[model samples]
Target: MVSVHRAGALLNEASCFLCRRRTHHHLRFPTPGFALPREASPSRRSSLAAPFGRICTRAQAMGTESYTFGPYKIHPGEVFYSTDLSYAMVNLRPLLPGHVLVCPKREVKRFVDLTVDETSDLWVTARNVGAQLERYHRASSLTFAIQDGPQAGQTVPHVHIHILPRKPGDFEKNDKIYDAIDEKEQELKETLDLDKDRKDRSSEEMACEADEYRVLFS
Candidate 1:
């Protein structure tokens, strides 16, 4: 049932539920199964449509990926860096080539939740990949960054650091494209979960690791 009162309450805040900021918006809920005591006026319908359109537009901008990071069973491909205990990949973003994401197989939501060894491996993997980027991709520098939550602009809750290879002229050095895309990359990470597990680690070690074990099995 569509309650006018409830709708009014939601509108009173005038904030987007997804982004959570005060903004004038409206959405037309399909009314087939909903009870409506009063018909929506033309102005009301128009107002709702605009915001709904914006929401859909923003959603369509973020494309979904087929797979997640960590140990997973798939066709064997190029292995970037591995410790027999962890692994990483060159992120698809490729700001200057050799961009990689270091993540655990376990589905840990926050950096603080990672077990000690997993935490160590995360940074170590990133560091190793960063060096390889310098040696192989000839990048002048590498940047490591993590977004822990939505407020921090972390779209995906999964903890991962972006290793971007920087070059002298990659950007005008005045543009903030990297930062903007980095935020989107985090969202992309949140949408996928790694499917494989690291077997070399003993059950005891795996237990202590914060990698996503259940998602791999399920």
Candidate 2:
């Protein structure tokens, strides 16, 4: 997010800005099985107590295993929601409350690079995730945005849709809060300066929030 001074410019100059990144996570339904990386939380570790075979899962395995945005590796334990084609995860530095990202599993850099199925699935997943977040965050509205390419301010070379839960009067100017893309990915400074001031949330903090969000999907 941002301040009122830059809000107006953001609409025109930014054009489109979504979240920063996406990866793997727990696929709540079909398996209820997600393998935490070797150094995962105790609770997430318990999820893999069953067997190594069950834990041999991927995001597409109806369970969150591990995946990547482009070259950046994401911790599997922190992703809370995903489908066969897409995933929704907590932002390391969210623009607003209940802000999250939904991305296709396949890391296609450009929006046009996605096939019809990936495009359809990405939007549908964003819609479903947004609806749940709206209810959970008890917000009045939501903003769904995507930065299609470098010119559009895409940073990670991956396609991601930002889902920001909005509330009245939350911002001096509502758009101010949505200043940049996902703050998390900006740490790597893949492309733009949308997020240059903030520090990142610790892995533990991310995993903790992700654990809480998983209930919304389950």
Candidate 3:
């Protein structure tokens, strides 16, 4: 048998749990066959919806619902692939035809700043993005590089792995790609500054690019 008590009130002739005194306003026990209507309580509906809400929130955090990188809150159309730990997107500037970047969800400056799991996921994601880029660009090779810090030529403060698909004669010299990195980054900055009309890719363009890459990754 269960007993419940309210302030100065006894239930079912039971003593008040707090005051230890029998009082009026006793509650009668329900008969065995009696039950509340299924739809009568809002709490039941809320309980049922809670898991679905949690699932949506989890999906949003994991990049299924949203994609964000550095200061940019990326549109869904810009994200080609994503995992719980990291996501891959098309590069704003391309050293090669199919260059892309893979980065952890949290912003960090250097490789050493990443946790063990993030470090592992970063490389794994980079590798996967490399393979996909290769197939998408029909390239025989790929260049994977990380500008670890400012001294190493990292333009963005956030840690990112650049995956550049390469083909023969793509660069006059193999080491020229390194020089191209600084040149391309500078050019992008200049374009953004000098060209007021220049803007990010439209939703339709990003969606199309994402779809093309998604097929390659698939």
Candidate 4:
């Protein structure tokens, strides 16, 4: 178990993730886990939840922020994913109208840090979303790309597996598809009001953004 002091040091020096800036503080020291103290035993405790309260409080005090990747907006929320996990979200920025993201509920910086169960659950969730995409959009295939760090193009420290639905005409000419998509996303960001205050823009507006991208690619 890591000590509180050590945890603090680790969190502070963390990188900005996407831009390599120092501004993003993605790591936090987990609360020390130990057997319950004698005084917190059920015999004296008023509630079973009390013993776990300190750990929860410490984690919350660590502070966190939300991020958007494509159409999915991730934060602390219940029912965020169709999976039973408490956090995660469906993709709003779909490559083929049904792409999704399968991510962990915790703030793990690297894919190697994921517990065996966490990794398994992530794949299961991706498969589930893939099924949905196939049923809804008639996708020919799905691509699950999991990049671990900077060299692999991981923008956020938190590990996320992008489940992209593949279609027949999604790509035809080149392999630099991601660069093209990122450029179009930026163009939409500039022209549309996707700020926190104006989060949800109409589908018509999104379609217009798509038209702008189609022109660029064409």
Candidate 5:
């Protein structure tokens, strides 16, 4: 079994099954003097039209602001959209090309743990995010899943809704995505441990993707 220990405010260590050793994973931290990519100019935001324009307008009317997800803050330029109760973010390990997570601002562990307001906001946010992702990825279908608890395959303790954009024939079997989700973290860990070239996506890369999505939803 793999065990994880929170090492500090900005890092965590997880035991590896292969080497029986611990590997430290750096939490996403703001880099000093880090600037947005040159290509991430404000004009980019105007190019990709948001499919769910009314959703964005509604969120703005609610005076919704960004919040923190784990250690990372959900900034306006880094998220597709957000409401007062929940926000959607780019996934670190995307199950598909356009997979993202919709999470409540409150750090709840299960779906049932959400407050009535949060529950409503979560699905509404998911729907908007899903629509945007489908348009962005030109997906034929979408998968909105919630792994309610650990027994139900919730890897991270936080309550997050998975919005996966799917294409026809993306997999030989339709249910393969679930198996892929179950094994993705472990597979990435093993690859990272043994193959030095196979590193996790850099913070810059993630921010870049987020920027693109921000543009798409703008």
Candidate 6:
């Protein structure tokens, strides 16, 4: 629970986010210096196009934006896009080429807990990111899904929308992907304690992919 004084200070910093993107001002502050990404020059972003394999070591991204998904701390490099309220991060174990997750910054476990503003920003972020992914992946369609809660197979407890860019006939059956998602989550649950190390694709892999996607927004 945030006090009035803290909330007021947040509103002051929110002007930075609102100037570039009309994002909500009341986003929960999980960490210091976590905010909407500042604009990067094309030359700075161009390096993102290179394959991750080319780089020998994993380095934190030049961008300052960072976020979390449930108990998992999302690294800065893995975050591609963000509004004041929400951010998009690559899936560690994707069912498709361009599968990603758009999550609210608040770490709200259930959808019902979301403020109206958070709800609106979450979907808007999804819609915007889905379009970019579809174009980038050159897919014929997309899959937008939300598990919503534990009964609905929500892993990690945080509410998130999964966006998968689909090509024709590649993933013909709908149930298959959802099944895969469930199965994968089950495997992760057994192994990961949900404390920072929520990785399947190495951090470098997710970071490189995010860097590529960052180019779209920049």
- Using TM-score as the measure, the top candidate is 6
Best model per lDDT: 6
Between candidates 3 and 6, the TM-score winner: 6
Model 4 Cα lDDT, one tens digit per residue, 49-151: 1111111111221124454443444432211243344133433333334344567766677878888888888788777666655544456777777667767
The superposed Cα distance between candidate 3 and the true structure at residue 4, in angstroms, equals: 59
Local accuracy by lDDT, each model: 0.44, 0.59, 0.56, 0.43, 0.56, 0.65
lDDT of candidate 2 over 1-218, digit per residue (tens): 79886776565333211111111223111121221222323443222221111111122222546777765666675677888889887776554556788888898898899999999999999999899878776778988988787676667888899897766554545544444443334543532243342234445445555655676677
TM-scores for all candidates: the values are 0.49, 0.64, 0.64, 0.48, 0.61, 0.68
In model 4, what is the error at residue 146, expressed in angstroms? Answer: 1.7
In model 2, where do residues sit more than 4 Å from their true spots? 1-64, 182-199
What is the alpha-carbon lDDT for the whole of candidate 4?
0.43
Compare candidates 4 and 6 on TM-score and give the better one: 6
RMSD of each: 19.9, 18.4, 24.0, 21.8, 15.6, 14.5
lDDT of 6 by residue, 125-204 (tens): 99999999888866778889888887788767888898977654544455577766665555545434644653344554
Question: 4 or 6, which is superior by lDDT?
Answer: 6
Per-residue lDDT, model 4, residue 116, is 88
Q: After superposition, how far is residue 160 of candidate 3 from its true place, in Å?
A: 0.4
Backbone atom clashes (below 3 Å) for every candidate: 9, 4, 0, 2, 0, 0
Residue lDDT tens for model 5, 20-110: 1111112112121121122333443232222222111112221346566544454453366667788887665565556788899888877
Taking the tens digit of each residue's C-alpha lDDT, what string does model 3 give over 1-218? 43343422333112112111110001011121111122223333221110111001111222346655545566665677887889887655454445677889888877898999999998999898898777655678999888887788876667888788776555545787777776565554554444343343333333444555665555
* Candidate 2 Cα deviation (angstroms), residue 115: 0.8
Error of 4 at 18 (Å): 35
